[model samples]
Target chain A: MSYLELSNVKKSFGTTIAVDDFNLSIAQGEFVSFLGPSGCGKTTTLRMVAGFELPTSGQISLQDKNLTYLPPNKRNVGMVFQSYALFPNMTVADNIGYGLKVTGKPKKETNARIKEMLGLIHMEEQHNKFPSQLSGGQQQRVALARALAIRPQVLLLDEPLSALDAKIRLELRLEIRRIQQQLGITTIYVTHDQEEALSLSDRIVVMSKGKMEQVGTPAQIYTSPETEFVANFVGQINLLPVKVVSPTQGKVKVGEQILQAGKFGHLNGNPIRLAVRPEELNHGFIEGANNLSGKVEAISYLGSIVRIRLDVEGNPISMDVFNERKLTIPSVGDDYQVTFPVEACWII
Target chain B: MKTKRINFWAFFWVVLAFLYFFLPMYGTLDFSLRMKKGVLSLLAYQKVLADPQFLASFRYSAIMGVITVIFSILLFVPTVYWIHLKMRQLRPLVEIITILPFIIPVIVYVFGLIRTFSGPPFQLTLTPFKTDILMVAGYIVLAMPYMFRAIDVGMQTIDVRTLTEAAQSLGANWAQILFNVIFPNLRTAILSGALISFALVIGELILGDFLARPALGPYMVEVGRDMAYQPAALAIMSYALTWICLGLITLFSRSNNNQRQILGR
Candidate 1:
């Protein structure tokens, strides 16, 4: 049985729909991420689960109990916000102890819990410092501690690292993963940053325009996106328009060349799109691999990898190559041939 | 050379402004010490401070000020918090309402209060106790503009919705969120507003005079009418009280700012 479930939840504000028919079943101790662009209802969906928002229809249940209409305080859920919403006047220990204090926990137990949380966040020495005295990273850690001190049924984080510097964000992301793993807490994180969602989540639910586009493991979401929207949103991809040659055989025609996709629907002789990750396409042809020739349009040298943009028969495509010491960099306007296995490209 | 010239002009203007503000206060202080003719003494202050009527009126006004501040905080803080969190669109209308106390003259406001409550379905002015009740309501109304503005500004500085959600998700109901989370965060703002409200109550004359209450404002006017040196002492004392309130505001706000600077928000 699922530990936490959101069944066909839909939320609409006035005439505009913010979330529609969102369904998910998360197991205990699993970390799930809602990944999408801004205004995609990812945060709204998370808010609904946290009881900050009410669904227009459907139910949210935890451990087989209906929690849809419960107020946030009664729901026993804990949430960390993007702004690290720590109580400014409280010391770190006091802030972490706030939930326990409000829940009327005995003073002895609350102090022990706060001490454990401070240790969990690795801030034992700084417990007396106020939120204002802490750095952004420290404050967020304190917020995480505060949320977890309640030993909540579920934990929700709404873009918690979006406000930090890049280095702190990376460090805090690792810290969050470590803490969540240690506690074995059921967690849901919402963010527009694909890297954060992809790296930190056990399973990701990619959403667009208030609808879930796909839900799968991180590798499945990245490698086998079921829709064009998911393919375009998750990572760097080259989408080439093609015409179907055979529906059952998964054969398609790109320009004059025939190519085989991983799958194709029952749309014979219909136009389709082949989506391939930029990193999957290799430079130069190899045996038993599909090849495509294109004119190099631009090349950008990122620190670890170089990305090359190409124009293949009026279609713009991108390919990523690892930067090695002896590797030769291609120039603009050069004719280049890239190869990929048949399984790399999937029809969306 | 150009910067030096600008600094000189700035210094000149500052000196002129200081003279404009302090010259009258200096004259009052100087005159207040002249009650013992040909020698400087604190006889005027001693006389004013010794009067039983002065002490009673001062005590009444102080109590009234404290009561007004408490009521204002109880009423305005939650109203402003609701306006910030849920009814944000009601903010403009609430702002206009808060300022009604400022736009309508206090005399007219007190007159309206007397007419409505002094002899109506609820005669709040039937006794001294009831009259004090009515007077407190008037003071809260008079102090609403500053109290609301200070708190609204404080609310703007923090994200109310996110903070409320965070607190609620941690098992805090509405009361806990307000008292524990929101109130502590707004301490500086509330203190500044409370001090301003207190100062306004201490010096308020129109309400006390019209209501026939023994407030410090009316007592000061009576002393000014009959005595020569005691009025200067009272004026100086009132000025000092206001300055102390302002000074406390500066002290509290500075500490709040120093803490905020550590967060860089």
Candidate 2:
């Protein structure tokens, strides 16, 4: 059995459902990310798991113990907020020692634990400073230290790096993953940043409008999205509307070309979407492969790579290629042919 | 040149507004300080401070102001935080109720409070604690509008919902979250509103005068009938008290801003 299991969990405020029939199982020591845009119920799910929010219906079990009805204080879960939520009135040491104090731990042990936590976060020197005296990154580290000092069964992070600048966010993302791994704590990280989710999570759960769209490994989620929403949301994808030409063989007709997408059961003479990543499309047309003829609409120079936008049969398709030393920049309105292997096309 | 012209006009308006507000206060201070004969004696201050009734009234008002601030915070903070956490949809209704005191004139409410408390159904007015209770109740109603607004703004600024959730996830219960998390963060707002409420209770005349309460405002009115310079002195004292409260608020806000700046760095 999974260490943490949420089955058919639902939550609603008035008439609006904030989290809908959400079901997930997190194995012990697994780091999962709830990845989606703002208001997509990622934070809500994390709150439910942390016992900050009660599920409107269904059950949440941690380590085979029912946790849905338990209050946050009794749940033994720790969460770091997006804003850091460091207690401004308390010094770093006091903040880190809060959970231990609340649980009635001995002063000597709590002090030792607080000292160890401060050292763990590399903030031992600043333990006497209040949260209002710390920088944003430092405050975030303190929050992390405080949450971890509790020795929780599960750790929850609600976009913990969202408040930092890009450089610090990147640095903390790796730090958080390293700590999660080192401690072997089951963690659920909620974030809207796709790259952060991809880089940090053992598995990514993509949500939309309070519903889980898809859940898979990073590579699986990026390469083979179950729906057009996941494909479009997880990364930049060129979604071209196509007509299914056959059912037995994955054949689809796009504009004036018939493309074979290999054997796939879902495509059968029905209206479908053909999704392809930009990196999969090459600059020159290849024989015996899915090919499209189009005019080069625009070319963006991005240092090491060139992004080419093509207007193929009235549909815009983008392709990215490494910048060659001796290559003519494709001008707007210039005719060009683009090709992609059959396996790159995903029918959604 | 255009920017300079805008700056000039802005500065002129600011100075004009300050003069318009402070000129009368300056006149009151000058009048209170001047001697009627030829010498500059401290006669006005002496007369105002020497009266037994004046001293009693001042103590009464200060005590009431402290009680009002305490009661207002006790009643409003938890209610507002609860509304923010649970019944957010009822915020507008709660806000309306908080400002009801401001909408109804004090004279009207005082009349209602006295009539209701003096009758057989509730003969609270006959008791010794009646005056204290009535005064505190009136002040609570009077202070709610400002106190609630200040707290609401503070709550909004910190995104109270998010903060409460964050605190909860850290294993804090309601009491711990309120005293340790929310209240500490709301210190500046609570202080500012408490100061305003304190000043308001100290200077309020209509309710105290109508209720026949032996408070500073009623004491000032009683002295106004017998002596002119004493009343002027009392007014100056009240103004000074308000100014001190405002100064404390300014100091508190400045320190909070500095702390935020240091944290931002």
Q: Please name the candidate that would achieve the greatest TM-score relative to the true structure.
A: 1
Number of clashing residue pairs, candidate 1? 0
Residue B256 shift from truth in candidate 2, angstroms: 2.5
Model 1 CA lDDT for position A160: 91
Across residues B1-265, which tens digit of lDDT does each residue of candidate 1 receive?
9999999999999999999999999999999999998999999999999999999999999999999999999999999999999999999999999999879998889999999998868799899999999999999999999999999998888878888998999999999999998998898999999999999999999999999999999999999999999999999999999999999999999888634423322
**TM-scores of the candidates in the order shown:** 0.96, 0.89
After superposition, the stretches of candidate 1 with alpha carbons farther than 4 Å from their true spots are: A246-248, A268-270, B258-265
Which interface RMSD values do the candidates have, in the order shown? 2.4, 3.1
Model 2 residue B265 lDDT score = 30
Q: How do the residues B142-245 of candidate 2 rate in per-residue lDDT, one tens digit apiece?
A: 99989999888777766577667766766777888899888888888899889999999999887788777788987888888987777888888998999999
TM-score of chain A taken by itself, candidate 2:
0.96
Worst 10 residues of 1 chain B by lDDT: B256-265
